[model samples]
Target: MVDLLRKSEAFISQLSLVAIVDDQIVGYILFSKIYIVDDQGNRTPSIALAPVAVLPQFQKQGIGTQLIERGLSDARVLNFKSAVVLGHPTYYPKFGFVKAEKWSIKAPFDVPSEAFMAIELVENTLQGIAGTVEYPKEFQEVS
Candidate 1:
């Protein structure tokens, strides 16, 4: 999946971040372009946070947290309106992600509501946005 996303046309290198310690990568996170499409077929651009990981030796440290924080900040600077993540219910909220359902957003696949979350980069960016998140074909290729 990582390779596919990186190679896909939709991949934006600027949105991929890594944590390096002593010249070795200790953590990584990728925020890729996605969309929120309403029932009427209106599409709202967004991002998807995926493949966030820290090396086993680096787990429980703050490396993962740093990666997430920095990545989201960069996304906001890039003018991304929002972001979604299918991640741990407890872990992601520290970054302000709420259940996407709060805005009537849904995931394309079955996932616990708590595990699928979204956040607005700009205040109220998702106020009127609602729909299933449309991930890139690279995701489907891996599934």
Candidate 2:
């Protein structure tokens, strides 16, 4: 999350969400632009949700949910077509996430199919836009 804050471009700033209490940050979520490149070399605009975090002491209290809601809501407003995530299968499905593979979309890395998920922001956006996901360059530095 910090790497995205420090290195990702301005568009990420528009969709990143935070939760605060008494001026202390309790949680954060980021939705950054990614691309889906097809065989013909066309690219579809997409977003990636990742690095959602809440202090260990704050987990299970809904702060993370609030962060995700805020982030994805803003992403829709920003006109992103779809969003992808590599997260717990059960946890993310509650937020409308589903296996990206279902749409024929694949993650850049080989992860468990259930854990690699995506959600459409605009109806039908992912209907035929399937390909490998491409994350921003700075994501390589995130770990």
Candidate 3:
């Protein structure tokens, strides 16, 4: 989280959000600009949700879910076509997320097909798109 904050210039700042609790920042979620390349080599703009966190004491109070909802909603208002997340398959589905493989989208790194998910902000936005996601350098640093 420190690295992401240190590098939050340019695009990341526009997509990051914090969840406040009693004047304290109890949770955070960030979305970064990403692209999905089609077989014909066309790149489509999208967003990637990563590192959503709520303090351990705040867990199970729906704070994390609120953060995700707000972030994704902000992404849509910013005109993002879709948003992707490499998280729990079952947990993310409640937010209308489905397997990225169903839309031919691929994750940047190796992970189980089920754990990778995507939600279309606009209908048919992901149609025919298939390629690896490109994350920011900060993500690779934590890997």
Candidate 4:
């Protein structure tokens, strides 16, 4: 997964938050940049929350939530205007994700409407944003 992420141009940035248990890596989460086409077909910047993984023994311990919250906070601090995620509908709203379709934004592939989500880091950043979420080619090869 790391190799595939490293090879993608759309991977503008990436971060890994780790949880150590007994001095061993027990959890990790990654965030990567993604692009979306606007009405005129020009690319707009955004980030994607993907491939968050925790060792089976660590599941349900709030490690994933902490990683996501910290990652989003970092994105905001770095001036990222917005973020999108394809994930469990029930899980993302706690981080402020709403249905992207509400803003006319669609994922490149078919997914449950509730599973495709987005959030604005700054107020009104997504005001005029609309269109398709295009993930990096590396995602396609491995997805």
lDDT of the candidates, in the order given = 0.93, 0.84, 0.81, 0.84
lDDT of 1 by residue, 25-128 (tens): 98999988898999999999999999899999999999999999999999988999899999999999999999999999999999999999999999999997
- Predicted structure 2: lDDT: 0.84
Candidate 1: regions farther than 4 A off: none
Q: Highest lDDT: which candidate?
A: 1
lDDT of 3 by residue, 1-143 (tens): 44664465425675777888899999988787777877677778887888788999998999998888878777788888898999987799999999999988888778999999999998998887888776666666664
Better of 2 and 3 by lDDT: 2
The C-alpha local distance difference test score for the whole of candidate 3 amounts to 0.81
Q: In model 2, which residue pairs have backbone atoms overlapping below 3 Å? A: none
For candidate 2, write residues 7-96 as lDDT tens digits.
656247777678888899988887777898887878888888877989998999999988888888888887887999999999999989
Backbone clashes in model 1, listed as residue pairs: none
> What residue runs in model 3 are displaced by over 4 Å at the alpha carbon?
1-10
Stretches of model 4 off by over 4 angstroms after superposition: 12-14
Candidate 4, number of clashes:
0
